[model samples]
Target: MDFRIKWLVSVLLIFGGILFCTAQERSKPLVKHVVLIGSDGFGAYAFKKAKAPNLRKMMENGAYTLEARSVLPSSSAVNWASMIMGSGPELHGYTEWGSKTPELPSKVIGDGNIYPTIFSLIHQQLPNTKKGASYSWGGIGYLFEKNMVDIDFNGKTDEETMQKAIEFILTEKPSLTFIHFDQPDGAGHNIGHDTPEYYKEVEKIDALVGKILSALEENNLMENTVILFSSDHGGVGKGHGGKTLLEVEIPWIIYGKNINSKGKLESSVVTYDTAVTIAHLLGLKIPDFWRGKPILEAIKYEEK
Candidate 1:
């Protein structure tokens, strides 16, 4: 071959090699889902006492934070809103189940109407990023409009919701998936937090966790994604209503993404911190109004 032709070909090959490497480096990993599993009315005491193998496995392989308190009143409506908005009750105003405006029958409580959710923030920040979403009973879908997430499924049966969460982990593989289990808390309300029914619900929830973990492992997502298991609020005798330990303190666990080996949060992390942690995970710039810090220490290490 002529010297000039050989030189040109060599240069093009080298340049092409560089581009290939760069593309590989920039390629987003398969580990995209951020599973936020909420165990309603599950308190620290319940976590410690509960004989849940799946939850125990998560604790052993994830970061632990104690004294994680929900907001004042500790009601689901207030706390879940705080979690999704990355703000306190002030921004997402719905502290009470129903604000008595003189007259009007009691209506269903909703978080989206009162608060702007993380889904909206995610859409605004990362327009191309699609999020996997499903909430059984939290009624958080209204905040995340259809345009915000490519896959939006809510208000499904408990079995259906749990299965959908697993399906998203397998097929959709969203960058963020918020899964809410309206059990234990629901059971506790109908029965009692410490009752047999509540415990049964816990067991069922643990099984669901196992299913999710199995899906992650089968789909090879355990190394990159962050699996967080938390509770909106804890219930006591029969329900959660006030700022008692049963109402405020709940389980906070972060698994995968090397989160298992991180240090704990010294200061008490509020419910709003969940949103902050999620935003931080996705490299989003949190707004100034956000009163919580990202739990950066709790990320599982995986090769990018």
Candidate 2:
């Protein structure tokens, strides 16, 4: 009888230890890498008719919203700046669509005399973390502090840009990677939003997204990686920078490890929220000056 009791106690202790270890692992941050993909002029409305199976799969498996809003004026540079800087143009001060520098002085300038951005925050907190940015737009290069980035590549086309981003991810295994595609915006400007040609451009971008996903999977980075997809702004007619719903509303999608498979997000998401979300995933300190809040509902682990 004493032998049986001892055996039972041993089994209980082993089981208890396993449970404790599992809980501890769950409480720790699960995301080790983050890939942020931004598509210029890819509006939320495009999903209404655009047959983007790959993006649709991400939306179904991850937390997403078609109602995420852009900052006022709904332009490229201002909204892109807001997305990474965690504040509006009032704080980050890139008010114009073609703004190469802050039209108004930034509310808080960090190490490089540039407004505090996600890249800056990550660099300050995780000094050894590899960071990379690949974009087809030349204007995007000027928004953040280049000195903090390890690899900054500007490709002549969206295809080339994403290809370079894949190469960087495979070779460098960067902790954070931001990719910007300039198509669909160029198509929207040259053609017209809501037109058939614009939809085609969005479809092409979707194919590019598929390629990126494949690369991540091939390199076995998907297990520890989280991907967030968003846009600078939507468009209406042949141009943007307006107050129309078609121009202000954008799509936001988050997928991968530690993300709740909440089909669609109900919470209100803004451009600045992207930065805060990335910071939260990487376990970095979100600056008090930033106006954005992390999308906690999409995360599986309870942040303490």
Candidate 3:
């Protein structure tokens, strides 16, 4: 072939190759990344009346349960561990604030609860896809299992924790992320569970939620992610670790493309079901030890 014709043929081949690569990249299924958010002291009553436009949008766009309940005494350590381990007060051990357990020696925060965190499980199973990413969950200064887990930001303020969360999801894009906001809870204990602080802090946290959502949107990871919003426990008469509604009652919202938007919650659900739910959504089997049902009701789409 002449030089001119050969050059033209090479150019067409390169263009075709580019188009083919683009098609393949676009065709790949979006990976399922779990982002669990905890709004401290955000109860059903507070959630219902809270003037949070972002939370309202999440409730409408996804799913919301009026009867969500936290762990016993509604303490952060118990509930967070329960949700991650997919166990109850019996299995996960640490069932109260400032864990009385003689082990771990660390403060009874996010890490004191004894159980397999969702992060540890997925990191072990999905190592190839996970890329060993660094993350900053909502709770700050708490130590959980360091086995393939990062809890750099634990028990921090609403804005601070959310900033860390957004940064982690945007920068690391972790396969699993859990965020806890100790706002209303920390504020609630000082001045009654249902005081002005609860309302004000919840609204503040809601703004952070919107900001995080915006980050996800900008990164184009909204559709590819599974979001879980819950609480450690509610506060009654100042602090939690009680069975009362003010302490145990919570609000649950799960949204994202992998979930079923219209699913209805049912039948005595608790924190134990959360970890299994995340595992189930990620196309992974619940471990034999995970004595919790996958909240099939909250899931909008049936896993195939």
Candidate 4:
């Protein structure tokens, strides 16, 4: 064979291999499913003190930030609302306790129809995507659009809520699934926020997290699912509704599907960022009304 022809063939083969690899990477969707787990009244200090092997392992395999800020008054309703809607109380307008808009029907909890939640946005943009949520505190249901979630369950306890969510994920393979646990918040109000009892509840939640992950793994869906774990707000003593550091500081953990392992995000990651990041991963558009930005660096992509 001619030397020039041989060299040309070698170069063509290398270029073809590169093209194939690039095509494969693009063919694999960055995120096909998202699991957002919200633990009420879970603070960074309590997370540090608790013996949560599962959580630690998740953190080791994902990008985390202990400084994820929660919107004030630091109450679960307000912050959870903010987290899901990707907006603050000023926009979503669910600041106080109880039902925000009692006049509005169930599955619709925002101030008006203007500020739709992440679920609503996802469903509206991609109607084919399946979404669901299970909450221990029923009030949290108000943050999301009802029709958007295929399976919505407000359970009696955290265990029941998590079990139902895991079952839903395994069986239905929802594009988005949210699970809210309210035990730490209950322990915070009943006993103390930073007490040993609160830590025990945190440990239990960690175990629950492990179970949820295991279910995803068992179903072979972990590769395409992005798992994000965070808390609504932290409590100071027996309650929140304050502006203290302990009450506002929260731990945010992101794992699975190209997320950086053992990565630490050095930025002001608020609770609302959850919606933004999820939207970005699933190739959905982040609405202009959203106040959060995607944590672009934490994801697996070579910075240009």
Candidate 5:
């Protein structure tokens, strides 16, 4: 009887220890890497007609919202800056579609004498971690802190840009990677948004997304990598920079590594929230000046 009681107590203690360790592991940050893919002007409305199986699969497996909104004016530079900076044009001061620099002085400046961005946050918090950005648009190069990034490649075409980004991801295995494809916005401007041509361009961008996913999977990085897909803005009839829903509504999708498959997020998501979400996933402290909050509904871990 004494031996059996001792054995039962030992088993209970061991089982309790295992449960505690499992809980601790889950409580800690689960994401080791983050990849943000932005399409220049892919509209939320286009998803209804666009046949993008890869993106659709991500939507089914992750938390997404087609009703996510862009900041005012809904232009490329303004919204992209907002997305990565965790603030809107009013704070970051990139008021124009082609702003090469802050038109107005930024509210808060970080290491590069520019507005604080996710790159700035990562560089400050995770000093040794690698960061990379690849984009077809040259204007995007002016928005973030280039000095902090390991690779900032600006390609002349969307395909070249995505390829370079993939190469960087595979070679460097960066902790954070941001890729921007310019074809959809270009097609939206030239061919017109909601048109078959624009949808085709968006489909091509989806294929590029598939390539990135495949690269991550082939390199055994997908399981621990978190991917967030979004757009700078939508468009209306060959031109954007408007207040219409058709021009302001963008799709936001978050998948992989501790993300819950809530499927179709009901909470309102804005462009600036993207940065906060990335910071949250990487377990970095949020800047005091950042107005956006993390979309906690998409994450599986409970906040302590």
Candidate 6:
């Protein structure tokens, strides 16, 4: 072969190899673990007014949107159910806070016809992968399956919830973990949304969030984890359950793993999108019955 022709072929082969490697890297799933943080009644307005240094820092490193909308009715039970089940109240059949012990329906793992919670779907699809949650609102416990969750702790206060969540992350290292804080909601009901006392609670929740993030950092799990910070519903005038702006709009922050650290995300997201997004991040099969769609724009990757 001619000398010049041989050099051009060698350069082409090298570039092709590089492109192949880049494609392989992009195809691999970026998230190994998912951490979902739920702060009840934490509205965007309150988040703006609150002195949440920790959460602000996280927003700087993640894709965030204060315009994320909640489901109709805007109640805690309805919204949590929508987020977990990836379906509206009509499909999930959890319209209201029913009983202290909510009974299981006909089927646990619903087919394409029936709606299933993300926990149940994960348990059925990825049996070996561990799943857990530490929630302050025990009522949310009704939405989960006992056998599906490895650790289903109901802490009475935000402090206890964060403590248990941090411990679970470090000790169990579950594939999926959910942490819920209830103080802000309680504060919203006690005082009012955007009130000084409510903002104080929001700040306190920020500190608790910092503790959990610190735990992840200490364990070196931040890079491989997708952390989703959100709220079930926002409140208005000392209560929620209305379609007003304060009740419908909430803040959502997606950080870590392959998430973009750019400015606020303009994507329109709702409570129902949480489960499908989690499934997508963990590389699980999204059920056809699910109405929510994954926020694919949040994923940042290079293509060759």
Off by over 4 Å in 1: 1-31, 98-115, 260-265, 300-304
Candidate 2: deviation at residue 285, Å?
A: 0.3
Per-residue lDDT tens digits for candidate 4, residues 1-304, read 6999999999999999997556323122368899999998898778668998888888888889888889877887778877878878777777765545523232334333535777876786667878889999988876667766799899999999999998898888888999999878889999998798899999999999999989888889998898999998888879887888798899999999889885688867988888888877877766666788788778896455
RMSD of each: 12.0, 9.9, 14.5, 9.9, 9.5, 8.9
Give the candidate number with the greatest lDDT.
2
TM-scores of all predicted structures: 0.79, 0.90, 0.78, 0.85, 0.89, 0.85
What's the lDDT for residue 146 in model 2? Answer: 95
The TM-score obtained by model 3 is 0.78
Q: Clashes in model 6: which pairs?
A: none
Comparing candidate 1 with candidate 2, which one achieves the higher TM-score? 2
RMSD of 3: 14.5
lDDT of 2 by residue, 163-207 (tens): 999999988888899999997999999989999999999999999
Model 3: residues with Cα > 4 Å off, grouped in runs: 1-31, 100-114, 129-143, 302-304
Instruction: List, residue by residue over 1-304, the lDDT tens digit for candidate 5.
Output: 9999999999999999997556333124559899999999999999889999899888999999999999988998999999999999999999999998989899998988899999998898888889979989998999999999999999998889988988888888778999988879988998898888999999999999998888888889988899999999999999999999999999999999989987989889999999988988887877768888789889898466
Which lDDT value does model 3 have at 95? Answer: 57
lDDT of all predictions: 0.70, 0.92, 0.67, 0.82, 0.90, 0.80
Model 5, backbone clash pairs (residues 3+ apart or across chains), number: 0
* Model 2 regions lying over 4 Å from their true place: 1-28, 302-304
User: Taking the tens digit of each residue's C-alpha lDDT, what string does model 3 give over 245-285?
Assistant: 76777778788875655644554667777887777777664
The regions of model 6 sitting more than 4 angstroms off are: 1-28, 97-115, 302-304
Q: Looking at model 4, which ten-residue stretch has the lowest summed lDDT?
A: 102-111
User: Cα RMSD for candidate 6?
Assistant: 8.9
